[model samples]
Target: MAEQKQTVSTDDGLILAPADEKQNAVASELEGSGISSPAEYEDLPDPDIGKTDAERAALDKALLWKIDLWLIPWLSLLYLLSFLDRTNIGNAKVANLEKSIGMVGRDYNNALTIFFISYAGAEPLTNILLKHWSPRYFFTGIIILWGIIMTLMGTIENQAGLLACRWFLGLAEAGLFPGVNYYLSCWYRRQELGFRAALFFSAAAMAGSFGGLLAAAISKMDGIGGYEGWRWIFILEGLATVFVGCFCYWMVFDFPDTARFLTADEKLRAMRRLRADNQTRATEEKISRRYVFQAVKDWKTWVYAVQYMGVLCPLYSFSLFLPTILVGMGYKGNRAQLMSVPPYAAAAAMTIFIGWFADRTKWRGYSNMAVSLMGCVGFAMLLGSSTPGVQYVGTFLGAMGIYPCVPNTLTWASNNVEGSLKRGVMVGIVVGWGNMNGVVSSNIYMPQDKPRYLTGHGIVFAYMFTCLFGGTMVMHFMLKRENRLRKSGQRDHWIEGKNEQEIRDLGDVRPDFIYTT
Candidate 1:
């Protein structure tokens, strides 16, 4: 009479039968176990259960590869449009946004801060919303809404109008990182998440690089029909977002269950694989508020959030001002825009290589730690030198070093949390917390302070130190926990039963949640 709700669970890969089929499923469960309630017998895992560490590791990598294919193009396009719209005003300043809108010093930065405030507020709600809605439609619609807002941003005539648009844009874009994190968890095991995240995360670099080139060309259209070239950046890119968002609605799969690409048998295999990989269904539980509140009180939440907070001071400060910094090298407007591309391109290159290596090695924390070192060194080199050749090289390295951590930090924190709701909430909280640093970043590079960027570099130097200290300690902490679990042999519990509570309490019980090598 109704469209039957087809389903699967990690416990048994077979499509879960309706109430009528429970007799059959129980018969099957009993066939091999010779036990009625699996709980009574301790529900020991099958002897032929999953691959060995090496084999499971390979499977994890393979699964990561699939998640990457689904995530990268979609997430990248979303962030590219989201970020391009957010920062295009920097490019717009080149085409006279300040003059056009009668904006004075600090007004633009203030506007950026306003966006973060709304953005930060909206992030937490995403974890709850993402659970009920199909990530495919939810993710697409959010981007489309933001895109519309971005296009509207182009028509602003005054400071208030521009500021209003930016605020609305932030509100619309808030759910993305948390939403995507929840989406990826539906597919990826913890170990493989970082590289996949990096792939999608690196889209920010592509946006930065291509954004400059496109904005430069668009700026040339300034005098046509009383519209500025800067305005066109918003109009064109925003429209592109709308188109892409709509397309993803048809293309993006909701979950393993709803994905038409997989066959019925394939879906069962997928669920079983995840079960062996130690992931329980994130979506099966009740709605997430009570769990979210508990998650907020956990120590790991603070630790993960703080680790990222350390990086945010440097990462956002660097990304937001990189183009403005390039303009100081005595380059022409077009040249400055073009110059922004190379350093970001280098970052993009670094992100891909290291991300792959991280995946292959299955060491999320270590990978991020090493890259953070590179970023620190790169930023340091850039800070100490003034020669154009050296400075240019330093900027490239700095970029290479800094941005790679973004996706890694996101993955690192996310992988540690269990449950769809808890992961979603924590991811949103961590990102929202990171955005707070932007307020500190906005004025760090004083209008009068250029060429040297003394204050800004000092801030970055301190933040990098924090990242090194916090990140290194956390990595060691993760490794120590992993080793302890291996020695004591409590790994089975992690694979089958433990949910959010177990994960939070016994960091060592990280069965297949490999510390990205």
Candidate 2:
């Protein structure tokens, strides 16, 4: 089919084509995108109106590099600490946290389950606070709070004490993952978000690698200060986290409009680029009850939530159990910790590459579906195989396949949502609901299923398969059909009588707000 010609309407409501080849070229860029009226068209000013294509590209590259240097590294460090602190219980378990605390029967699983209960419950509410308090203050406060909680965890003498610490830790950590994701959406364009999100998320993969090596080294510190190796692990890592959190107050930038690192020209371009990127809505908007209701009403929000749940279930299972799985593979003590590093290291490399690939191809759902299949195959191997070597290989495949899907899935959801408040609400709900899958993961890798954890492997395999066929594929087709309808002008009726503010407030409900599948 030929590209649809874009039109504008004047005060008299006369429809006309763009005046010249330049305006036509500009309009053609948003071809099939349902821009509601001439007013909405004017809102998305051409970023390259005066500059040559090469000049615009060069400037964009330099600006992105500056943004990346300031944003990605610090955010990645924060998440690295958060993930390490959250999952370090697994490492602590390997070092005999259960034996140390006299945890018996289901006590270990209960501890893990309690964390997620608090975590998922706190997630939706915490993102609201992120906007209210500002990223710098909010992140610094939570990071320090969690760090203190984690440090005290080292001193816990019993199961009750441990559970209490874990619960508070969950509340403190509830914000960081989803908070950083929403924060990223504030600065980057749709196409740029996936790769940046990947870079930030890959830090979690690196933390897994780092955690294993660090835990191995720390476990040797047993009896150094009348503390077990696991105790030392918590104390040292907690201190490091607190240090980073203190630095975050200075290092973390707020939104782009108020970013201190950018020049006046750079700030203007940053805002303009985002306006051009999201054609139908303002780049930034105040939080409103209406947006919260709109986000809750959007069916796409729930679909994304379910899709996120599918991937996170298996991802959590794999991350929390990999060391135990390796120990079951016959690697003992610190050696088991050492062996866990390779899978996460491989996963970190693969995640960054897949993120770049997804952004380059603009194939978020497709990338997720493909990776989900890889995860299914990996879990199938773990379920079917008897040999330790085969199961070890499965770990590599599982880590690599599952890790990348997170950033892709998140960016896919963020890409489709318009306006800041609505996007934040949608992301918060999706993340909160998705993280509830951690409960399922924590309980499934039962103590009875050790060595050949068949039941756990089978269930996680099913989850990954669901991510492939039931989640990403379904969402892809839904978005594709919506785009097709908008291209045919079938959705134009949505904007017929709305004024400019009404149209802007309608956000993605507007006909021309194209969906990125």
Candidate 3:
């Protein structure tokens, strides 16, 4: 059958063309309308311009709720397990896993370091592969693999066995974080991302709080079936993760276009709504090497990575050491585990609230800076106070400040990038770099630095300050400068006269692509 030709309007005028000629027609129309470059096309009317406000609002609410119901819970659960399995070693350490395994000196730290090294190293490659595979299969496969590795952790008879399990565990878990971020971006608009990202990330905070309680209860099962409580912690939690993965495999939605829950009209509405946001369109475009190269060349990826690292190093240390910190503050056994719960609980609540606020205000960079300052104050309190009560308060402040920034930074990177491949690569790079600091975190606090851990607190404090400065500079200088250039009629030649596919391939460097600050 012959292709049907159709008439479409552009800024210049209406033109008759085949459906497949849309890009060329639009480009010609744009060129004829004094829009010589893509930068000048920023003011083009939204693709959803025909929709009434009432219609849009109703559709948006319905679509968002549907997505929230179908997507967030499953993703959050996955992240929760990822965080729990990774950080459960911390809980186990306090439960005497070290004595059982004969881990001495910096051996525990080395185990943590090795996990992150593999975790960070595998991220980029995993993300690229995720782009090629079905999200449901890819995600479920990794979760299952990691769950198996996590279960094997309980069976480790020596440090070498533990180290090998952690290494493979990291490799299994590497794809989830960045892959989910990129996946979410494909479905939701930038403004809607913060809370969703938070919704996903607050699971980590929940894991911290819940892991403590679970570990405490499981610790009571020591010497059961010839397994210690710490061993039971790994075995039980790992099994639970595997169970969830198996159950939720069918619930995972690939993208808006391929979502099973949505009706045909709803699917079209979802895609149109995203396109109207003037961001990258969600499509299963083949992984392009050019997009990967573009993402690598984009300085924002590295900048965001560096900024994220400052937060991650401290956050990782905190997650891995909070129980120990509580123990040092005079809580003992199950009491210390229970005591570690409140801070994470508080952080979880604050993470959701801040995510909502950031989305509402559309000021991600400012929100990040504010949270970093809060973290600085929290660390200051820890440094200044010797009293346990005051230090416990510091933990609350630290948790609140640190946890929110994770989602914020993740969303911020997703918001600024365009194109699936570029976004995927960028998310991978940023998250990979951020997690790389887990190495630094692992070694930052030694066993000798117990109780106060002054050196650890000080290092985190300094990094918080660096995060503040970096956030400020990026918002005021980099993003602002790009916005100004585009607003002032300056054009990025890279996108000039490009067809739709070419422009999409250009990612955020496209002249019309405005960076959200």
Candidate 4:
């Protein structure tokens, strides 16, 4: 007699019976739903259902391309503008913004610190609203409001006005970075996300490069329209951001299932692919307090947040002070602005390459450690060398190292987490916590410590090394051990259910789910 084959059934009514038994079991399940037999089911031309592996892969590739075309450019543009607006004050400071606005003492640093306060505080609420409202409306509305605030920043005549504008700008912009991150997680699988995130985040590096060039060009616009060049920087960039926001209102996609561009079959295939990857779908699950609490309690969320904090301190300081640093190295005003561009351009290229490599290798943690170590070396060079040329090279090394690690850190947190609600909450917590370094960074490099900011460089160097060690230990020791336990048949207690949502609600703690380190 032949050995008996085991059978399994899924909550979705899919039957995993032997070839001969499969048809009958499937037919029996469908009979209750009015499909009388497997023959009739097979006769239906439902391209979305029952696809072969080759066909599924082909459709997934095509759908991903369409998603990339529709999503990445708009999001990248929006992020570029956000970063430019946030850091343009640095460019403006070089062009006499402080003198023009009568900012004195630590007012500039205070202005920078105030932005992060509102930004971090509003992050969780903004993420909740992003889910409640559609991404199209929520994201566009955010951009428009921040653009308005940024434009008003050009009109400020005093420190108080500038502070108010910066605070409101932070509030308006709080949702965008984390919102886009969570949105990407909904569309792409873990392996695909690193590159997609890099494409999205490279915009920030591009913004640093482009903002320099734009500031250089606009510096000539001084006294044009009775406005200073710094004023023109804010006014023009803000107005352009508003225009793009209005245009993207009609163009930006929401979740995959609700995206207007995808066909019925494509939408079905997209959701199916995502479900197959991690046994979860990006459906509009109820916003449960339990999900938020679960994400907060996850040790990986806090560890990754701490690692991100190390990256952000140097990144924020670099973006805000690169022009000033270059000027201090004996470059003239316009020369300093132009000089700031190269490091950021190099960073953009490195970020894209590293992102692609991380995805291909599926080693997010190791990739992050490598890049972060490069950042450590870069900072060490800055601290040890007083030569202007050597310090300039340090900036390039720092840029390439730090910027590439950002996308990996983000994807690491997003990849390991499960469920839309849990992932959303986790991303918001991680990003908001990580941004606390913005406050630390703003205060680290003061006017007294200018010309090299040696103290600042030392602090950032130590932090990068901390990030490397923390990430390696967690990945190699904690996550690896957990994977082993799961593979060895040690399972966490979980509730069994006939409903898919119930199982998905278990989130990352579900026994079958293995974290991507």
Best by TM-score: 2
Q: All models: lDDT?
A: 0.68, 0.83, 0.82, 0.81
Local distance difference test, candidate 3: 0.82
Comparing 1 and 3 by TM-score, which wins?
A: 3
TM-score of every candidate: 0.82, 0.92, 0.89, 0.89
* Tens digits of lDDT, candidate 2, 81-167: 999999999999999989998999989888888999999998887767898899999999999999999999999999999999989
How well does candidate 1 score on lDDT at residue 270?
51
What stretches of model 1 exceed 4 Å from their correct place?
A: 1-71, 478-486, 489-517
Q: Model 3, stretches more than 4 Å misplaced?
A: 1-53, 468-472, 492-505
**Candidate 1's residue-wise lDDT over 1-517, tens digit each?**
2212222232222222344555654654434322222342233343324435555445544544665676668677777777777777777776677788798888877877788788878887776776778777788778889889988888988989988988888888888877876677767655556667777777878878888899899988887878878788878888888888778776677776566766554454455444444455564567746777767786666777777777777766766777777776666687888888988888887887776676566566676677777777766776788776777787877788777777777776766665666777788788888777777777787677787786787787777667544665775576668644543445544445556555543432344333322
Ranked candidates, highest TM-score first: 2, 4, 3, 1
Over 1-517, each residue of candidate 3 has an lDDT whose tens digit, in order, gives 3235454544212233456866765664333221223342463343344666566667668878989999999899899999999999999998998999898999999999999999999988777887677788899899989999999889999999999999999999999999998889888887889999998999999999999999999999999999999999999999998898887678887788778899877776676556545455556467668777888898888888878888899899899989888887888889989998999999999999989998887778888888888888888898888899999999999988899998898888888876767888888988998899999989988889888989989988887788544755665478878766654446445555678777655656655566667
Native-to-model Cα distance after best TM-score fit, residue 272 in candidate 1, in Å: 1.5
Q: Which of the numbered candidates is closest to the native, going by highest lDDT?
A: 2
In candidate 2, stretches whose alpha carbon ends up further than 4 angstroms from where it belongs are: 1-22, 25-53, 279-284
Residue range 96-184, candidate 4, lDDT tens digits: 99999888889999999999999988886667788889799999899999999999888888999999999999899999999999999
| Poorest 10 consecutive residues by lDDT, candidate 3 | 31-40
